[model samples]
Target chain A: MIGGRPDMVDDEHRLKMLMVAGLGGDEAAYRAVLGALARHLRGFFRRRLASRPADCEDLVQETLLAVHTRRHTFDRSQPLTPWVFAIARYKLVDWLRRHARQDALHDPVDEWRNDLAVEGGQEADTARHDVSELLGTLPAKQREPIRLVKLEGLSVVEAAERTGLSVSAVKVGIHRGLKKLAAQFRP
Target chain B: MRTDDLVALLARGAGTEPMAVPARVWAMAVAGGAVAAVALMALMLGVQADLAGKVSTLAWWGKAGFTLAVALPALALITRMARPGSHVGRLPVALAAPVAALWLAAAIQLAGAPPGERLALVLGKTWASCPVWVTVLSLPLLIAALAALRALAPTRLALSGAGAGLFAGAVGALVYTLHCPELDPAFVAVWYVLGIAIPTGLGAAVGPWILRW
Candidate 1:
């Protein structure tokens, strides 16, 4: 019953069985599961960081490494997505935080602007830095939704799909975040 | 890393160390903890003064039964969560409902009782020490349970730790029943629940660090 994708529920069941089988030491199943997860992580990272497609592969690798290293922590009796994505999301946030600071300190004006993409890398960097600062002023509940909807230009339904919140909940988060941002900025 | 290279790398090292089935690990850990708690209580605290007369009452059974009831689901969740990416659906509500029902029942029973007596009902005699003893008694079980979980993968370390702590708290409360003569449902609802919560909190606090691979 989640947004835009009917396959989400099936993926949950498949991932659970795959993980359980993998934990039982089935090598083939384990590979299949990780491969499937790698694909999912690629899409997951790509959607949130559309402006930074080049980094998605690295994020996927990092998340996969986390999954592999922390494999023992998965619960065999629970749905797999929340657990897997929890790590992916954690990695994504960490990546953002680390990158956010470097981008803020460096001036992008000196960098070459690529002509092919709709927005140049430097423009994206400036836009992202400004967005990150704006978002940083809000709490995570509000900040995440604002980034997904207003900054990344995802539809409310799309943002809900990414964040696992309901459409209404995402809307509410954006509303509340903007309210707080507005209050903070007003004279 | 491309998917193929990652897959090849992951599969090369893809094997779990052989370990006991999850059920067995759960049983041994829970049983070991329960035994230790009971033994510690007997060695140090002995039975409550009027236990002989009170042993046959429903209140005594309620005390034991309440703890066992809460412990079972927590044990199942902890055991299941020991494996990576597994879920124990609906088990959390299973743990919470009984606690809620007892509190509601206690409120109804004490509704018409004198106001001062109501205070007596909630505090009982061991209010001060009950929570502390529950945590103390829970230590062995919590240790053993965490040890059991260590062999398996647990991504949600804090949650797994809380489950272990809850399991220990329940069993500790079960053992404490031997020494605690508090018969009022209100007393059990308040103090005994608090006792269970102590380890659950401690587990959450330390879970991310201790259960980390």
Candidate 2:
């Protein structure tokens, strides 16, 4: 099922595989389709996570979970790569925020404030070092918007609403943020 | 770790998350869909008897298009209103069971009839046939709508079902406007409106109560 099929098969079959089998609970089919995605996603994270080897596995796991959860959104008729990467892009930004010690709404504000403000010892320093190294994976512009939006748990509308910028501009900020992250580890 | 190693590790490694699916939630969805289908069938049958005397008064396309226009939007809205991520995901699929049965009945009625004869058959069986495909296609749309709702964590079913109803209304109206014949706005206004309204209302009314899980 893997190498036997031609790589350039029509998008319809891929979508059918996803919809009929994937939605219908064919685990083998799900794995086969997602296997290619794993490689592509790994490459994406590798480029953004070169300096933060420790975080790569966690990032990849989180991204795959998202892909599994949101797989239905992939219109069966469209090319698979862009959809996969869009999810990957979102996951990557989410990881970067977690690394940077940003507050997410899901996290209790009091606990988060206590963890960041009070725990300022060597343990915090090492964790910060790892996160900052990951941050170094993306340029500052990319990191800043991600920190504000994803890490801060702001919706695109909310981010724009708060920043007094257009929603399109916020999306552009996220896009440019990714491009800059991609540029950091293009070797 | 090697890429292969990582892949294998993640592939085999135990998922830290739970795989628990709420059983009662799915049961309620299936049950609600059944109730909605039955209620809709009753409503349509009532309309058929009322319209039987006037079957020849309306044009052929007028009758069929009225049915279609109503069916398409109503189905779309019902499916759209059911959210994907919640327990209601199964509602569309469950609703499909009844709708499919109705479609089979309609197709059988339409089998030997000529175009002109078709209107009479539909008038007799319209209540039965139309809900099948509407319910079938709606399962997926319900899933998408629910996924969008998951993050919102709406506290009230009325709010969520209302959202689903509005979406169903708009989608139903738009789709009907495009494909259905505009013969008698009166016919369209009647059966077509029921076609859309019944399924949508069913989804909305039941969506919150059943999908609460």
Candidate 3:
């Protein structure tokens, strides 16, 4: 019943092919799959998180990462969209659970405007500023690597070179920095 | 970081080799846990004395068959849970079949027995220790199975944990059969079920916490 429609079948087939190729170490296919999943997940979360629209992108990113890390769990025989949607749903449930208390506090009008602003270019600047402010709170060792590798879009090796740290250290810094950043979001 | 950048990084990090298949992972977990449980059983309680004599008996086969039946379905369910959006259709029914059959056998056995012997049939010589030992033995398998589930993605955390626990319980009961001498269908239907239930409850209780990714 899932892919009964022609369009749905095509979408499922295409995503499944890309995913299978991605599992076989095809970087382009993997990137393609991730990009495609991101678009779907953004819409998926936006609809569910309408009251907390600002959190939609964060949930999309989280679900995408989860899908990437848990890629091995995908059974090739199964349809890809369901698997992707399941992960998206799990992330949505988790986010909702975590932010349950904040639900009542959010102003619907403000959130609607925020959602529109995020669609516009100006919100990107505010997001970047907010992210930098968060990075500033981390220790220099953790901050520098995340700022370089994540925020600045540098590879681990490049971040290592810039920070004068070993590649492993840079990776560790990013890992720890992300963990700290995530912890800050928790109550 | 932006979502696009995150995807690019993840794509870059995708290893040349895919992870071991789910079947292989589950096999290793079950095998490893079985070995640990067997070892623990041997250390705590030696195998039943009439080993050669019991092999040909109907009770022995019944006990083993029941445990195996439960284990197989539990295994199937747990594997399904490891994947997202996979249907667990008919698995719960499969898992219940053996239990229902055993209960039927137990009922017949109890009915045929004399009034005074009914309680005795249900409560065999080792009734008190059987479930306890079975639960104790399930610990290692539960740990190993949970670890395996953790390595894979399980969207339904509590269900996955319950599946793992059910698998562990069935396997643990299978391992317990090595040392247990009781053979009454009533005893197995009651005590063994209790033993398996303990871990299933434990798994469900802790699932939301431990299975959090």
Candidate 4:
């Protein structure tokens, strides 16, 4: 196991280094951060957009572009993640606005089908892994909120902002989604 | 996880990619600095005229030294506020005014202003007075110095403000020292104290509102 404080300090320093590099316009540093953040971005879009891969990719691109244009706005002293995610959240909202479909207003489901794919390999693992399958069984309305807020680690406020729902609406979606996921697991 | 493993993961997974700055931004930074310098010069002239009219009792050097002493506490305040982790946000900045005020008060007491004058007179005098012009001019020079720093402040208001304030105070004090008369504890306590206090107070109060993105 790694020691904690040093790791923390080191992480902080690396974060600073990334900010400095971005500020200084270093291409290598830019690519490094982009590569690292891509998974999170994809996950973010996946959870919020539900099944809309194209919309998610479009948002990811837009967010990246905003990051580029507003890079100078970043304070070298602040945390990089919060700032980036704040931008990402805003971009997601913008995306939702531009592409407002009749489907978006519906309740979010708790679809976790990808997690269930892991269960196909073995029966013993499958029983233990039923929770993932159950989560996948949730409706899209519930699944989307759960995936975005819980799996992707967005704050309720942020998830609401990005998904274009009221804070209470998002909370309820999570509550209902979780109830269904729990019931499915037991059943 | 091992330190190396965690490090690798972190390095691999940094916050986001670095964004390229356009040539225009750099040009804007330089242009902004130049403009601020010109405005500061005008303000400095006015300040000097105001100061000279108020403090006829003391020699030019005395007034200059007093101003420099008052400006010192700003250094600590500015440095602390400029760093990322600093909580020197709006409330904190507002809260900091009293400390600056206290420093100004201490400077005046230390400066030993002439017996006939009131403490408020020392601080309230315009920067445009005869010898006071020397100190007054420092404000513009301060503005110019800060203008250059603005390039670094696009999104980081508090840091930028702190950097600008600290820098202006330090440079202003240094210049004042060369031209200022010998230091008197009494002079430092009064004029110098107020000089720093007023600006810091203004900055603390106005910084948040003006700096928001």
Top TM-score model: 3
lDDT by residue (B69-177, candidate 3, tens digit) is 9999999988889888988999989998999999999999999999998998898899999989999999999999899988777889999999989999999999999
Q: In model 3, what are the clashing residue pairs, if there are any?
A: none
Each model's TM-score? 0.62, 0.33, 0.84, 0.37
Q: Rank the candidates by lDDT, best first.
A: 3, 1, 4, 2
* Predicted candidate 2 versus true structure: per-residue lDDT over B74-101, tens digit per residue: 3343333322222234444543453444
lDDT of 2: 0.45
Query: Which lDDT value does model 3 have at B109?
Result: 95
Residues A12-54, candidate 1, lDDT per residue (tens digit)?
Answer: 7887798788878787788888889988888899899886655
- By summed lDDT, which 10 consecutive residues of candidate 4 chain A come out lowest? A122-131
Candidate number with the higher TM-score (2 or 4): 4
Q: Could you give the fnat of all candidates in order?
A: 0.35, 0.00, 0.56, 0.04
Model 1 regions lying over 4 Å from their true place: A1-33, A51-55, A69-187, B1-6, B13-21, B49-53, B80-89, B146-160, B208-213
Q: How do all the candidates rank in terms of TM-score, highest first?
A: 3, 1, 4, 2
Off by over 4 Å in 2: A1-36, A42-59, A66-78, A89-187, B1-6, B9-35, B38-49, B54-213
DockQ of 1: 0.15
Q: Residue A14 lDDT in model 4?
A: 71
Q: List the lowest-lDDT window of 10 residues for candidate 4 chain B.
A: B1-10
Write down the lDDT of every candidate, Cα atoms only: 0.74, 0.45, 0.82, 0.47
lDDT of 1 by residue, B95-167 (tens): 9888987888789869978887988878888789988887888889999988887755566788999998999
